[model samples]
Target: MSKRLSVETSSAAASSLFQQCTPFGMSIISAGFQRSAQLLEMSSLHPEKTREQILEQADQEWIPGTVFLVDVDRSLAVQHEGQSDIVLIPQPSKDPNDPLRWSQTKKNIQFAILFYWSFMTSVATNWNGPVWGIWVEIFETSYSVLNDTSAVCWCFLGLGCLFLQPTAMTLGRRCVYLFATLIQTLGNVMGGVAKNVGVLYGVNIMTGFAGAPCDSLVQISTTDIFFQHERATRISLLTFALYSGSYLGPIAAGYIVENNRFGWRWCYWFLVIFFGALLALQVVFMEDSTFVGQRENETEVEKEIIAQVISKEEGQVYVSASSEKDQNVTVFEEKDFAAPLDIPTQRTYMQRMGLIERKYNDKRPWWKIFIRPSLTLALPAIVWGGFVYGVQVMWLSLIATTQSEFFSVAPYNFSTAAVGDTNFSSLIGCFIGMFWGGPLSDKFVAWKARRNNGVMEPEFRLWFLILPAIINSGGLLMYGLGVNAGVHWILPAGFGMGCLGFGMGSGGAIVLTYALDCYPQLQSEGMVMILFLRNMIGMGFTFAIQPWLDTDGMVTTTWLMFMLSVVFNMSCLIFIMWGKKWRKMTKNLYLKFSDPHFFL
Candidate 1:
């Protein structure tokens, strides 16, 4: 009977172990356990294993930006890198405070505030376009001299992005948002009372410096609060903010200047008032979205081994086992280890409103982070993406600078308000572009992914660019040729301008989505290079538009712009075919940047 009881006990132990490992899709966890076992067996739980080392091992085979977006077969339940049943990219951590896990209402509220700032600040910045002719008369300056003010602003806009983003990364995003608002408000106040072109120059400088975050921080915040699939739409909204404000600001400024009561100076005063209101809203609602996760001190293997030991023995525990020594020993832990992770207490409302979140303690030096953006230019794909959007910005600058100069004294002889009204068509086109660039692109890519066994490539974004490229390049030809022929204002302003607006809105979305999807490591830095190249090209064209118009005549210049736009915009075809090969070539560099601690 005793012998029979021994046999039954052994059988029971074997069944319990088998049952423990039988949960559905538990094989994924077991694979990780195998890695954890190998980790221990290699060095008997080396205490000095750094977070970077662990991450490098975990990230062995995966390429940057190549992700399994959808599960084609029902049998597939978990992604190797992420635990989500639905395969959400940038998988949400269990921490309740992670922005990814925030409630939809909370996420929407925060994003709405960011979108508002992007729109209104752009409005304040570009109000000068409609008033350029009026400024020429009042300040006794040439149109080129007036355009120089914008040229200065564009230069500073790039510089501001480089300098301010590091601070935003280090101090917290909200601090920079508040600081920029204060500076812009000051600039607008000066613009209202300015007596000369020099004062206007100063106004542009300050405002441009303040507006840098519009490109860099706004994109970072978008990525922080949204998932991979969701980001294209939200980023497109940011592009819309830029287009609408560029077009609408001049419209608002035109009417304000045309009013008998307000006059041209009131454009700045109106911005000052609006900016004051924006500052208040931002303070109340634009919560800092920065979150850098901390690595656990203990490994999964450590947790499993320790849980079998006494809870009292865990004051400071170290497990040292070696095949050479033929013994396993668990001793005092040198570092305190918390029990398995549970959702930490959620922050109170006041805590969330604090200027900086307590958890954002990235130990990398601020200067290193500042220089990182510059290093990204070495990536060939990044450089190519910059040229694509840089050309689009070149067109935008042309529209803003040329419209007042062209129509203000043409056969059409448009008044200031009428010049502003041209932008209404641009605005309408932007609305359509937003829908095409954002939701439609997302759904289409998703459908394509389903067809491709549920694997989505970053290059998938470039496929839709074909439509935008043709429309945009054609729009340039129409606007230029129409102006050269001095046709009715309706054709160039309505159809041509509308087509340009569509390109700006849709093109911005596609290029931005593609670049970030290709290299999401430190997204702010990745975007900085693109915008830097964009602003530099924009600044160059801002200075060149008039000279070119004078030197080559309207017809020749128009043809030249059409061709330049065609070459840059249509290059998406080349990328569409070979982008995956390029990505594979850069995979090592991408992996280096993706590591949070790689620089350190």
Candidate 2:
């Protein structure tokens, strides 16, 4: 009779706490505790189960972190008529202002615009790769000196993000996007008319800095508008645009350089014309997506409520709704409340351009932006992400540096157009990867979650890395060995280059998606870190590759690169086996360093 009374008292306390906190907060707290308890018991019973396996089980039982898991099996809120009831992780608010609540058509339109913007900028940045041979002769400079121009540009690409990210977050993405496009367009015009190598080098630095956002900002925008399940596929699409533009640039530049009527200068002229057109479209169509004020207030309220409930000194006796017999604790179903669809007052055309100034809380030190991204480099995941992206940049640089030089001389005397056309092999591979990588990753995670009883963990996505790893490693070896042996150019150019693109497309997508999944709140800063590392490493390789090739020859250099690729690609295993423990260990650190007001 006394024990029964104690149980009743505990249940009453839990009911009171539940009533105080929002359903989202309650679900997070309850799921975390329940999952922790299950892991403890499972570990004791089955010591052989890896932490990843245990975490997968925990995810099956409850959603990770503060994300509210939806019940797809029962929820009636369908995305479309034919679609099944897919669970929405980080359950969408009924608020019409919520990005998740936006009509699918609106989201798709935004994505298309962003995709085109990303593609154009990437094409402009890399068109110089295939034209390096022409530039060396025209500018009366050595190969090494001209290469430094590309290296400087790549380095600036990384450094530019240090300034761009904070400004975008504080002001608005639209403002930054327009400013970057305008500057890049002007820089291209300057580059096209430059008379000397020094002028061209300066222009490269200016344009490179302006173009940095093309790669980093798109990922942030995707996260701003899309859900977790949608991120992988969306990121894949962006990656496709990025690489396609990059490869296609070389093709176009090659033909342009080969033409007597339009030479190397015309390449820059083409970018000037294209970017000028792109800027006009951007000013007309783009809108600021940052939801700072409302999101910040909602986060504070949620935190205060959570604090009140968790501050109680009572023992761990609270009964969760999930504990009830035959009852599944679905946060979204707790109260079938729908907020009024409040339509925002439409803005004027100029207002839509986001040129109007808005006040922000600027008390936070601006230097934190620069400092925090550097600190994130200490994370194993960040370092790994850097390696995954950086290595691909390095390999591409190797090809860019060597391709024109080798093909224009000796055994197969290919014309400038032929040299440029060879990039088509890589373009095809990127297309394959673009299609295969994203959707497959999303599907893989969903399938794994279902198998684990409807709980999903980020590590489940890493399994797809294996096939790409093998393809990338094999391609590196093939390219190196074939080049050294003086085999048919197609062997290295066609098969080897194609494989590299395939691997880069797929592997790069996975690493980026993983980073976002690990720290959604700090995504802007996280991407800054990724860009910093990726470009810094890329710049270093750009500077080093020509000298290394000179010293080491094709066989030794390629073999060294191959070895590095294998080692780095294989490190995914470490994350798969112990990634959960690392996440748990860093949770407090992440919370401490990350902005508190940016809840999903």
Candidate 3:
């Protein structure tokens, strides 16, 4: 009778354990329990061991959730020789197939591909701006109309993502990337052959629509593959590539249009060729990083072990069945402790290419994907990020739209090639920011973590914004004053542009990294919010700047821009001080709106 009572208690405990383990509502618990019961039976021979002792033993084992064997206090620390202090947040899984577990070589390759794609797409977006001067004559359109074409394209760039990002979530990112590239390439071809300004306008809109992913998707992909500690650095690199392409495109276009042989149309042709190459590279290299489902099936014993480990880590005591009646039940399975470094070959190349490994079952209305991101604009951090980037975009548009006129008719009398060459200063600044921004922010976070007993918060990254804000404001003032005073053109073109690029690049990195760090679950949507505000603000500025300049003159307009920059840049202080409080306030809202399956 006593034996029967013990067995009944054991069965009840096992049933309860199975229920807790199967959160996804899988019915495989019975099968798993059968395997677990067999192991428990063997353990029944070891009656002397207490439940506490068993759990203590399990805690010491190198289980998934257990304190890592390398360091108990710093479980997330990597085993590198010099960088042992650097802890990887959102600790990488032991699974070989995990993207975070991928080799550094593979990660670098992926980064390169993403970087190149971002650079090329940005080049495509702005290449038309510098060549607009020549298109005025060829297309028989006024400068305002041609400028409007570029502004429309900028707006479409943001609007396209509303639809495309949802498709990326439903269909795989790789598929969306391929499709967008194809559309962009075709659009470029059409633009190259366009006979009239209307055709050019339509093609520009098409290209902008297709190229939208370049702004947001690449950053999302970076987050997908990299750990929290690595994201800021990778994002900084991506920002550099993006800004490089933006600054370089106009330079190349200016010269391309100036060349009598190739002329303005070749600008679009160049994009066609570039995107065609990019499309091919993406097909061969980019793989779907989206999680379909768990691919590994652990036996019941393994499941029990994992459960015990998780419970131990969470400070929950797990009383085994044997513990109820002083039975010696010790279940021990030989653990595979080796870390699998090589990529698994479970899926065939055809399956990878087809993206058919696991079909995503996103039941949300398709339009919700489009609508949800726009709703994120209400979030303070998201809005702040958008505002900071939008101001920068306004400045960028001001330069791109007005530079040709500024240089052509001024005391400088810069040739098209010289105008193009002037972008080198901006490029240099971007490089500086790319190198300086990410690592410094990362180090700041790490240092702060060290000071805070290893508790790292997202707000640590925002401290770096102060310098960038001041530098950007100063640069705008210098450029405006230099241009108005007709100080040697180099003063405005080189020093001013360089400083502006550095500030914009660094500022962009800070805000983006902060947003991603704060709400990683909503990264894609948050990015969309930033993109929408950025482009819309840019379009507004592009439309208003010419008229504003006519009325207020260059110095007043530029000083106004500088004041606006100061306001936006200085807003980072509010985030740094109260960002945490804001995040806490909006936590329920984010949980309510965010897709649970995202980053699965």
TM-score for all models, in order of appearance = 0.82, 0.80, 0.78
Question: Can you give the lDDT of residue 583 in candidate 3?
Answer: 78
By lDDT, the better pick of 1 and 3 is 1
Q: Kindly report which residue pairs in candidate 1 clash with one another.
A: 316-332, 316-333, 317-333
List the lowest-lDDT window of 10 residues for candidate 3.
Answer: 325-334
Q: Write model 1 residue lDDT over 1-600, tens digit each, in one string.
A: 999999999999967776787575478667888998897886675444443434344345345566666645422322222332234556454455667666677788899888989998788777677788888888999989977888889888888998888888787888899999999999999988999999988998999989989977898888887877888899899999988999999998889888999898888888888899999998888788877654221122222222212221333332322112211111112122122356465666788778765576455788887888877876767888888988988888898898898888868788998889889988888888898889999888888778876667888888888888888887887788898788877778889989999998999888889888887664677888888888889899999988989899988998899888888988998889888778778877866776656667
lDDT of 3 by residue, 234-287 (tens): 999988888899899988988887888987888888888988998899888877
Give the better candidate number (2 or 3) by TM-score: 2
The worst-scoring run of ten residues by lDDT in candidate 2 lies at 320-329
Off by over 4 Å in 1: 1-61, 74-86, 294-342, 597-600
Measured on C-alpha atoms, candidate 3 has an lDDT of 0.72
Q: Which stretches of candidate 3 lie over 4 Å from their true place?
A: 1-72, 75-85, 93-95, 292-345, 355-357, 360-365, 595-600
lDDT agreement of model 2 with the native: 0.72
Task: Give the top-scoring candidate (TM-score).
Answer: 1
Q: Which regions of candidate 2 are displaced past 4 Å?
A: 1-72, 75-83, 296-350, 356-365, 597-600
lDDT of 2 at 271: 90
